[model samples]
Target: MMPLNNSMLITGGAGFIGSYLINQLIVKGVNVICLDNFDEFYPRKSKENNIKSFIASPLFTLIEGDIRNKELLDDIFKKQTIGIVIHLAAKAGVRPSIINPQEYFDVNVNGTLNLLEVMKNHSVQNFIFASSSSIYGNNLKIPYSELDNVDFPISPYACSKKSGELLTHTYHTLYNMNVINLRFFTVYGPGQRPDLAIHKFVNNIYKNIPIEVYGDGSTSRDYTYIDDTVTGILAAIHYLEINTNVYETINLGNNYPVKLSDLIEIIEEITQKKFIEKKLPIQMGDVNITFADITKAKQLLNYHPKVSLKEGVINFKKWYEKKLV
Candidate 1:
């Protein structure tokens, strides 16, 4: 069983999911040390605002550093009494990864390696990795399972994540580290990163901007909400407390896929506005669909997602009006 401590290190703790995770941990009175470099994937200010609400908390520490920085991670490990590591830092977005494969590999793969090396040195064995459903690639299987073959990744981002999982597995095999890689589906909600489809569509429609419709708007994704994903992360940590001698991957998703066109319609209905649609060719690396088989999550962690797309879109629009407006 993994050791219990008050402190936990969460990389990329300033991003959308990290912010929510930090907040929840803070409420539970866990000492959370957030490490983020504030990469320009989006504006630094938005990411700063994500954790600004809880930045001043006594139990929270925000470290501005890159995952690629071994010295910085070493310093944090040496100084702080962190019991577990939640690795969430990555160069996100499949389209951007295509344009800059080197940067993606460097940050996603090399950075994860650097962190794992540091963790090995410190003997911090309990770990929770934030993986992506994009690793499933264009598989013919519906409702991709943890047992599915993920050898064929179309984008550098997916490849990077898959590499991270493999690295984690090796560590588990050699060091007996406890690890759980969570394959998060298309996560969307209030304060979501602007690059995601649901947020972009809602914002563009509100501003009367033309929305990009890729693949004739038939592409579908299993959109998991922020709360459900965070709950699963906490459960993984809890599971690690009692279980060890294991390396496992589970899908933390809603298990319900929504089409791009139907998502647009929901946004329009929520905002009471129509958007101009601009059709684009099916992107080369884009997958046909992403449907998660969350059966393992339900059985292992008792994970049950409670949000629907319509309700989630409404919630997103409400937060968008207040924050983005």
Candidate 2:
């Protein structure tokens, strides 16, 4: 890989995926500037702990701010020579978005616009967006592809992500920016967000609490390990580095869909605990499935997911146990 000429700015850099991506970039001798507002969706300490190790590194710089603030974004661009912008900051979760649609649009859509405007003004052309598979909605397609028509989004969060993808493409076409929109599948592993199913289930089972199983446990997700997702992201960054006039939307996923019941069983076996399963009706905004077609990722970026669901769950278990100590 060619050496980066300037620092990479990752919005939401203190979050789960952002923190992991920053660690990898810094290890490769690349400078990183992480911007995060540390939203109240989860505990602030967890996000803080995510990037605690990187605080002292000369290659890492954390900016506590919101993406909606165009002034702050402009000031950041003016001060730092940023080579690439990985926009990962957004109002996440489908259910939460349904409860607060306006906030989702304001942050995910307008905030993205703010960043793009700043980047355009500063002439920073390289960009990568963290999109979501939920944009597929409840499409009948077994494996969601980039070519699939995603005109119908079921939830506000999904709509927000679809909006982000469109915004990136618009910027790419008008500004001649090199961009990639990566639709991430269900990502889980060590340092995973506490709100996610895997993390929540693991903790609940470990404590012998009843775990909620929405919709019959038949609903499935293409659970991609965090390492695999980050690998695909880095590959996308490299592709942007070596190519030009590029605008591609690709899926970074495990490609293997695991039903909710199977996921719980794996966690149960791994943690050596019995789970009290509380069945609940499928909540609104929750999709029936999320399976990714990574053929484009494989061909374009040579990306392949290496971690299996069981293995990833084991890794998370180890990390959670260590954290408890």
Candidate 3:
């Protein structure tokens, strides 16, 4: 069992889901060490704002660094008594990964390798990997399961996540590390990343800008709410605490797929603004649909997603409008 006093090291803890996860854990009085590089992928100011509330909290420690920096990671592990490493750092975005496959692999795969190595050296065995449903990659299967063949990832981002999972499994096998790779679907909600479709659509509609619609708006995504995703992560941490010799790949998703056209409609209805639709050809790395089978998550973690798309979208609208002011 994990010692209660050990700090939980969460990489990318300032990003969308990472910030939310850290918030929840902080509320629960868990000691958290957040390691983030504040990448220019988005405005660093926004990410900084995400964690502003926790700046004064005694339980929170923010380390500004990259996952690829082995010396920094080694120093952190050497000093901190970290019970678990919840890895959320990665070069996100399927299209961007296609353009910069090398960078994606460097950060996602090589960076993950660096973390695992440091964890091994320090004997920090418990790990929760933030995987992606994009690994399914235009799968013919309706709802993706842990058993699905993920050997055919289409994007470098997806491939990188798959590689991380494989590396975790290798560590689990060799070092007896307890690892849980949670494949998160398209997570969205309040404080959603500016680049994500939901946030982008809402913002564009609010600003009277044309929102890009690719592939006749047929592409779909299983949008999991941020709160539900955090719940699953916490559950995984608990399971890891109580269980050993565990290596599991589970899906933490809402199990409902929303089409691109329908998603825009929802945003319009919520924000009370109609956006000009700019039609474009489907991008190279874009997938047709993503639907997750969360039976394993339910059985293992007792995870049940509580927020509906409409409710979550409404929450996001409230947050977005407040932020705009």
Candidate 4:
């Protein structure tokens, strides 16, 4: 086994998934540089708390900056010997993207371009990009696969993610960069983004506020646990190291799809509180269901998600109670 050295950069490192990835890498004795501008989509304090555990570790370095800043990225690329670039930074909400499409494009597409340009100039080849299931749009298919057509994105955020994947493909084809675009499903568990449904529902329940149920509460999502997502990412990293000849895209998600009502009920059961249900029309940019076909990930990356929704929710509720109190 190759030893992890001073050569891993995780963009959006202060955020939920990025923070978890950073910790995992650090535990493996890898020197990791985390870069994030602390976008206003969520409270900065939350992101700060997310990475608080790594603040004192010598192997961890946090660079408070934006990926859009080409000069800053160039300086970092020159200074550090980065072996792998995990691109996870972006303005991340789908509904917000509907109101401001340009902002989404600038941050998601242009920012990714900036990173790729810097990597190209520095001759850093390895990359793992964070793509989304939103790119699948409203496909009639039950479980989305990597081979599924992703041309029709319903929201600006989805379009931006799709654009990022395309740009990654371009870089891999032209610059010979070894890349893996992981299309993450609805990831939950501890350290989830406050804007996400699970977090919002938990917070609302704690505050004794109404939990909004949208679209007759039938919308379903492949609620993947954070641990499983991290496992998939680590597998991808190992897979890329061994198979450096090609670039690939894979879906990382729980095969099970949980409905909105069922999820809420589980939360209520965990909290032992009755939620004041506020039913509303499904918001735009929201999909009816998201189910990932992880066969490709299993075959290529040996990815297998272990945590079920019930187990994940119980774990999250315990954390939420502690944090809230």
214-244: candidate 4 lDDT, tens digit per residue: 8998999999999999999999888877776
lDDT for 107 (candidate 3): 97
Candidate 4: 10-residue stretch with minimal lDDT: 1-10
Q: Model 1: per-residue lDDT, tens digit, 1-325?
A: 8667658999999999999999999998899999999999999998988999999999999999999899998999999877889999999999999999999999999999998899999988888898999999999999899999999999999999999999999999999889999999988899888899988888788788898898888899999999988999999889988887868999998999988888888888888898899999998778989999999999999999998988888888888889854
List candidate 1 stretches off by more than 4 Å. Answer: none
Which regions of candidate 3 are displaced past 4 Å?
none
lDDT for each candidate structure? 0.91, 0.93, 0.93, 0.91
* TM-score (C-alpha, index-matched) for candidate 1: 0.98
Model 4, C-alpha of 125: deviation from truth (Å): 0.2
lDDT of 2 by residue, 1-325 (tens): 2237899999999999999999999999999999999999999999999999888999988899999998899999999999999999988889999999999999999999999999999999999999999999999977999999999899999999999999999999999988899999988999998889999998888788898889999999999999999999999999988887899999998899999989988888898889998999999999999999999999999998999999899899999999999
Q: Which stretches of candidate 4 lie above 4 Å from their native place?
A: 1-6
> Local error of candidate 3 at 135, Å?
0.3
lDDT of 3 by residue, 197-299 (tens): 9899888888889988998998999999999999999999999889878999999999999999899888888877888999999999889999999999999
Please report how far candidate 1 places residue 191 from its true position, in Å.
0.8
Q: Each prediction's TM-score against the native?
A: 0.98, 0.98, 0.99, 0.98
TM-score of 2: 0.98
lDDT of 1 at 274: 88
